[model samples]
Target: MDQFRSFDQLRTNELSVLRHGFFKLWFELTDGQFCYGKLSYGNFWKTIYILEVEKKTWIIKRKGIFKRSFLINDLDGMNLGVVTPEIWSRKIRLSMNNGFEAVYLNKKLISRTFTLTNDQFGDILNIRTELWGFKKPFKISFDLDMLKKIPELPLLALLGVNLVLIKQAKAANAAS
Candidate 1:
C-alpha cells in the first residue's frame, strides 16, 4: 500500500491514469514519479471498484439491480456519495454527503475530452483520453485551488475515469 499523504505534495497539476496490465482493469494515478492513488476492481464480476487515496479506501458499486447510479461507501459501510447519470444525455452528476455536488460532462458532443465542474468552482478538472493505447489511458489536469476546495477531488478523478469506461462500454454494446 502506497502512503499518499496529500495531493498538495504533488509537484505538478497534471497526472496520468494508466492501466496496470494489458488485460487488467486496474489503474494507477501518477504524475510520472509519485503515485497519488489507484482504482481497481473489487470483485470478479466488475460491478464494484475500490478507490484508494491518502491511505483511505472506498467502494464504488451499483446502487441496485435495476439502477444506473453507483454508490460510494466508506469501509465502514457509510454512504458518502452517489454518481447518477442523466437521462438521454452525456452528463453525470456526483453528489457527496458533505453538500458537495459536481457534474462531469463531455467538452463536446463528439469529443474525447470531459470536464468536471460545479456551480461554485466552474471547471475544476479536465480529463482527456489518449488516442494511442488499447487501454485508453487518460490524462487529467486539475486546478490546485479548486482541488483544495473539494476534498474528494482525487476520488472524483478516479470516478471520472470509470465514467469514461462505462460510456465506452455502452457505445461498444450499442454498436454490436
Candidate 2:
C-alpha cells in the first residue's frame, strides 16, 4: 500500500471516507483503510457496525433488515442523534453495479477494494469491507440525539476528513 500523500490526485472512494475519526494513515481508496480499529475484545462478528456520512449523519443497520427493497435516498436519520445502519449512506450506487447483488450471503463475507496509483496506477492495497449487506435498503434509519449521548467512537477512522472539509469550505467561498 502507498503511504504517500497528494492533494490534487484524489479518488471518489478516498473523498467518500476521508472525514473519519479512526483514521491514522491512509494511502488511497484502492488501499483499504486498515488502521487501528477499536475492535471489541470478544470474538463475535467485527464488521463495521456503523458508517458515518458527510461528517454529520450515521447509519446503524438492524440485525436483518438490510437493503432489500429500497433506494439509497430512502435511508433516513433518527430524530435523536443516535445513528442506525439504515440512515447514513448516500447511495451513489446503481443497479447491476460491480458487487454481489443476490441479496444476502449465508456464509461469512468480506470485501477488498483497490485503485490504480497516480503514476503507475496499479493495484497497491486492498481496502475495507462490510461484513453484512442490507437485505432491504429501507430498513436503515437513525436518531440524531443519540449522537449527543453516545461517547466518541473508537473505530473513528479518519480519511483526511478534516483536511478535505476545510478545503471544500475554502473553495465554496472562492467560487461564491
TM-score of each: 0.94, 0.19
Question: lDDT for each of the candidates?
Answer: 0.86, 0.24
Residue lDDT tens for model 2, 1-176:
13423222322222223222233322122113332211111113322223232223223322244532222111264322221212343211112222212111112222223211112222222223323422110111112332232222111222112222223356698999
lDDT of 1 by residue, 1-176 (tens): 55664787877888998788655668888888778888889877789999898868899999998999999999999999999999998889999999999999996878878899889888989889988865538999987786678877888888898888888888899999
The reply for model 1, stretches above 4 Å from the true place, is 3-5
lDDT score at residue 118, model 1, on the 0-100 scale: 89
Candidate 1 whole-model C-alpha lDDT, 0 to 1 = 0.86
